[model samples]
Target: MATDAAQPSLLLPEAGGGLLAALDIGGTKIAGALVDGGGTVRRRARRPTPAGGDTAVLGAALDVLTELTTHQEWRSVAALGIGSAGPVDIAAGTVSPVNIPAWRGFPIVERVRAHPAVAGLPVVLCGDAVAMTAAEHWIGAARGYRNALCMVVSTGVGAGLVLDNAVRSGPTGNAGHLGHITVDLLGEPCVCGSRGCVEQLASGTSITRHAVAQGWQPDEGPADAAAVAVSARRGHPVALAAFDSAARALAAGIAAVATLVEIEVAVIGGGVAEAADVLFPPLRDHLAGYATLPFAAGVRVERAALRGDAGLVGAAAIAGAATAGAR
Candidate 1:
């Protein structure tokens, strides 16, 4: 477990009083945090997800909660929130993440609510992308945007939306699944049973695969997206082309969202966005071509202000909202 007492705080004047307990569950890690109304992380814990059966995954999540329960501030927690990798059914209180195959339609909400430490506290569940959107809208780059698209472009592409100044989670909590949107009429197939999906072209995994296929080799490390970014920085043509291809696909998808919702901005985050120098320039160039409509032409692209703590902060934001609605 790791704790950061000096973590910078986000100003949320309307956050009200009390603390929110948050859990961010993904393929790699299961993290928990006690966040104050002002968006400051007061306490935190994490556990690496084990590659085992369903019980093992649930056990790891419970362990994180147990660690958090030891904190003195746990007593003041007003609600508990969970943000898990999709596809989650908020109405059903279940999650079916692709990476965690052992947990199809897992009853996460009931299990978490059953915890002794969480006794009687309201619990909220949402897809990880939706949580990221909430975090961005609450205190990150989308703070003042009435309509925006926030994306995570890591191993895969995931996204959520902020519409009319509020996170729109739609039915089932997996509203903004931009990755599965077909961008190319004849592109690669996606694991989501779709052909020519944006994720097949724009994800970090796709970027690395494309760079490697184009004969771009790393100097002294794995042939991943970061290595490709490094090579692009050194003027490697193949690496640059790889990033440009990804940028183009992302541009297509972003333009589609802008056209459909008339979003004013698109806030991008995740591992791929870290290579901003190589990605953004080409992305902006391509976006200008696709988003040619009068309203869509004004769409702005910005990097997400929040990073590692986005999930926890976002979970807290939704939990806070749920708490307020219940009263």
Candidate 2:
């Protein structure tokens, strides 16, 4: 595991009081952080996720929590918040992330609460995409927006919505699952049993897959999305086409969200968003074509201000909200 501390910032001023213990659990890593009310990360720990059974995954998360307890500021933690890859049932306090197959309806909240150090503290849970949305609304690109869509386009695509100035996670904590929305009516089927879902075309994994299928070879390094991005920057037709395809799908999905809910802006993040030069120009162009309605036409797409720290900060924001509600 690795640990670090961050400099203080004046973000999330309303998040004053005690600190919040936050956990961001994903296929790649299990991260924990102690965040102050002002959204500054006081201390953090991270560990690679084990590719094992349910017990192993739980153990990894528990280990992150154990390390967090060793911090001097742990005593100031008011509540524990968790953001996990989903589909999660916030009401049931369970999670079933697609990538972590061993955990179907895993009792995440119960297990976290069972931790001795977590005793008596309020526990909050939400989908990772929703957590990102919370962070954006609190201090990132969507800070002042009353309505917005926040997305993460990594190995997979995920999204969350903010409506009327609040995160709208919906009943199953999966409201803004824009990836599963069909963009190509007769396109290839998705793992979610849907045809032409945005994730199948817009995710980093998909971008690489599309590029490779189109005969785009990398100059060096592994043939991943980053490599494809390099090729796109070099003006490779196949690589450029792959990114344009992803941007088109993303534009379709974003436009759908805007048309349906009238979101003022779309804040996009995750690994794929790093290819801003290749992704944004095409995305903007495609969005203009799809979002033709007067209200939807004003929707702006912006890169997420908070990068990697969005998950931890967002989890802390959820914890802060839970603590405030309890008070």
Candidate 3:
């Protein structure tokens, strides 16, 4: 977790002078930003996550947060919000991300509250997928929808639900965690101690593992999902098969979600989603077969609109919700 002084940027008002501090904490990176009311990102900083140490990782996150304070607009910041990799406990203000094993049940809310520069403001927490759902529902692809499911298909599959016109992050902040849902109840063992979960078949990590195990190799670097995507585009049989399997699994999971929540849209984003040309067609085709029920057939699948900014925008939205609740 090595960091140098950050170059700060100043953000004036886009719509209003109301500003918020936002943080997006994942297993591999921590990003912080100052966002105004209009979804404008005024300033941002990122720090690489350190491996295997809770204190060091928290220090890296704090470094990113401290960088946000260097902005000229810091004085007007009204609240703070964090979208963290979970399972997060909103009531306990703690998180225990499987990727960040050292932080079992870590009390993140209390620690952020103690940071002198940003303390005293209301701090909010939500799972990363729920945060993304909030951002999309607020201004991105899900804006006009009354119900939706938004997903991130990166190192693992994660998703959240918007039901009855609000993000349903449920108690303990782990609701709408679509990855661990058993799509193939008798298929393969999942790391979440479940069998045939969508994450076991459809995540970027799983895709990469399947490709390599089937003898798909890049000419150089380790064959990740991105590499597999490239090979699939080149018409490699094994690569294409991997994507087909993953896409089908993803479709099954989406169909299940639609059946349960009655969502109108399914928005997807993340590194793995960058391979849509290889994944989307098969996903749509498979979805038609799985979503046989009348209520679920109309669910429209879509690509995420905000891309990299979604996480920060979503974090700000969480804080904005808190600010409104306090009124």
User: How many steric clashes between backbone atoms does each model show?
Assistant: 0, 1, 0
lDDT of 3 by residue, 1-327 (tens): 111222111122223566988888887688998888777788999998799589998999899989998888888888888888888998899988766777889999899888889767888888888888888877777777778899988877888888866788888888889888888868887767789988899989899989989999986677799999999999999999999999999999999998887888899988888998999999999999999999999678888888777788887778777667666
Residue-wise C-alpha lDDT for candidate 1, range 280-304, written one tens digit per residue: 9999999999999998987889998
Better of 2 and 3 by lDDT: 2
Clashes of 1: 0
List where candidate 1 sits over 4 angstroms from the true fold.
Answer: 1-17
Note the Cα lDDT for every prediction shown. 0.86, 0.88, 0.83
Model 2, span 1-327: residue lDDT tens: 101222222233244557888999987788999988777788999998899999999999999999999988888788889999888999999998876888999999999999999999989998999999999888888887888899988877889998877788999999999988999999998877788999999988899999999888899999999999999999999999999999999999999998999999999998888999999999999999999999889788999988878888998888777667666
Instruction: State residue 216's C-alpha deviation in candidate 2, in Å.
Output: 2.3
| Candidates ranked, most accurate by lDDT first | 2, 1, 3
Tell me, by lDDT, which candidate is best: 2
Steric clash pairs (candidate 2)? 15-37
**Where does candidate 3 have its weakest 10-residue lDDT segment?**
1-10
Alpha-carbon deviation at 310 in model 2, angstroms: 1.0
Q: What would you estimate as the lDDT of candidate 3?
A: 0.83
